[model samples]
Target: MNLIKTLIFDFGDVFINLDKEGAMANALEIFEVDTFPEELTHVNCRYEMGLITTKAFLEFYATKFPNLTQGTILHAWNCILRDFPKHRLAFLKKLQAEKKYNLILLSNTNELHIDWIKNEIPFYEEFKSCFNRFYLSHEINLRKPNSNIYEFVLTENNLTPSECLFVDDLKENTDSASKLGINTWNINPETDDVTQLFDVNKRLF
Candidate 1:
């Protein structure tokens, strides 16, 4: 295998653990619904893509569930995010110090998620400093599993798809990158660790 020149990483599940099921339950309870509404999913997509402001997003939820407060809606939305492991940060820092490969963070995250991270994680800045480029979906107006987003990163960074390794927790995201000729690792958060990068994909290194 050819040596990897750049490493593109996903944040949720890969770096920070998420309670996806729990968050879904929380949202259902907050909205008082038996199942997730289709409109809510559309709004969420817009929110993630930065097509809608946080205020507008919250207002949409407020209009749907008038009984719930803004705080409750925000809390339900942020329930998916959990702790950021220190060891992963240490591993990333070491990689940055070595400067062997260009490190990039590409996450399908919104303002509220980032706001929670900044307030909850004491070393949020320190962790971010390790990355050569940090691309949040909301900030970039793009989301994963979409070819345009992957193409944008490759074009912007002047990186060859074959020389870049993309690691994401979602199969669809990894599959999309693989189609672009980028090496990919669809990491399982339950059994895998980002710190095991070199050990897991030794051929690339």
Candidate 2:
């Protein structure tokens, strides 16, 4: 390997543990839906693609389930909020302070998730400041599992694919980046913590 000069990270399972199933169950219960509705799934896809605004998303769900209040829907949507371990943040910060490889965060997230992070995680602002660059799928209108997204980051940052390493929880996303020549680490948050990847200080110099 080229002794990676840039580190690209995924947000959801990679940084924080997301309660996807829990959130969906809550949403289903609040709406009295039998299973994950197609509309709900489609709306989420749109949300992930940044095609719809958060307010619009809430309204859409509210409209679908007229009996549900905006607050209830919001709560269900935000049920996925989980903790971002301070140790992980601390490790990344150490790399930042040491002027390590350019660090970037690329996440496929939505408005509800963003809102939850701001309100729930007290260190959200501090955590974000550690990255050299941040790219949210919803904000960028592009998402992983798509090669173009990987290309966009490479082209925009003027980074060579061979010089960067990407860490993601999803295999599909890693496949896309790999096709573009970016080295990848398919990390399982349940089993692997990112700090074990490399010596932060050593990687920098």
Candidate 3:
């Protein structure tokens, strides 16, 4: 809360709602597996980090689950993403209008998921415009829970971690930021709304 001048946000579960558990259960049922295999997760991480192309990602899943087609795998993968609330976009635009802080979006997203979002959310560009910097993991070749990603943001923006606040739904993501002296709110998506930011973290404001 040391005079925060920047706000770094996580996209999933922060602005856009996600069905993580539901998506997992759906994939498990389809794949006939109780838990995701290590190789599957590895491929996914590579995909998210931009080490693999969209075609390669789909082919990996299709080849591994030979009984399923690429389209089926694509559907299962995208099912995790859900609604991007208009209220959240309003909140962001309001923040931008105030011009009190720099707004940044740092998300662990991939090509397919973003393509789907662009088609589904008509105001996607407007929402993105509110941010000073919009970074997708695949585009940046970096993903969170890794300290280097936070460092990259800080270095690129010439920001001091102590003067920045990172809001994320994932504790691990927030924890990583906290280590670098960044103020953080590990928001609970079920009970918390991003529109209530001022009230929830009033001390920082």
Candidate 4:
């Protein structure tokens, strides 16, 4: 394997555990709908890309579910986010201290989810500090599984794809990176831990 000079990581499921299905169920229950509205999905995409403001995103939901309060909508929307493990933080810190690879965090996250993380996770800043580059989809106006976003990172960093290793919980995101000649690890949070990165991917190291 080629020497890995850079490591790109996904936030959700890779570092922080996400209850995606639970959050979906919570939203459906709060909206009192059997299925998610197509319009809601469209608005969500725009919101994730920062094309819409948080107020506008909430207002759209408020209009759809007249009986639900904004607070309730916000709760359901943020339910996907869960705890960040201490072990992973320690591992990242170790990596940062070593100064071996350029660590980058590239997450498909939005304003609300990030807000929740800021308030809920006391060490959010410390975790972020470990990374050389932090790229949030909403803040960057780019998202995963899209070649442009990956290309932007490569171009901005002057990184060679073959020397970068991307870790993501989503297969699609990793698959996309792989197409560009980057190494990828499709992590399964159920059985995998980010703290075990070096041990798990020993071949790469």
Q: Tell me which of candidates 1 and 2 scores higher on TM-score.
A: 1
lDDT of 1: 0.93
On lDDT, the stronger of 1 and 4 is: 1
**Per-residue lDDT of model 2, residues 16-41, tens digit only:** 88887788777777777789878778
Candidate 3 lDDT score at position 31: 98
Per-residue alpha-carbon lDDT of candidate 4 for residues 129-186, written as tens digits (9 for 90 to 100): 9999999999999988899999999999999998999999999999999999999999
Query: Which ranking of candidates, highest TM-score first?
Result: 3, 1, 4, 2
lDDT of 1 by residue, 1-205 (tens): 5489999999999989999999998888778789998988999998999999999999998898889888888889998999999999889989999998899999999999999999999999998999999999999999998999999999999999999999999999999999999999999998999998888999888
Residue 22's lDDT in candidate 4 = 95
> How well does candidate 3 score on lDDT at residue 47?
95
- After TM-score superposition, what is the CA distance of residue 100 in candidate 1 from its true location, in Å? 0.4
lDDT of each: 0.93, 0.85, 0.93, 0.92
Clashes of 2: 0
Please give each candidate's TM-score.
0.97, 0.90, 0.98, 0.96
Q: Which pairs in model 1 have colliding backbones?
A: none
TM-score of model 1 vs. true structure: 0.97
**Which 10-residue window of candidate 1 scores lowest in summed lDDT?**
24-33
Off by over 4 Å in 4: none
The candidate with the higher lDDT, 2 or 4, is: 4
Model 1 regions lying over 4 Å from their true place: none
Q: lDDT score, residue 7, model 2?
A: 93
Name the runs in model 3 displaced over 4 angstroms: none
RMSD of each: 1.0, 2.7, 1.1, 1.2
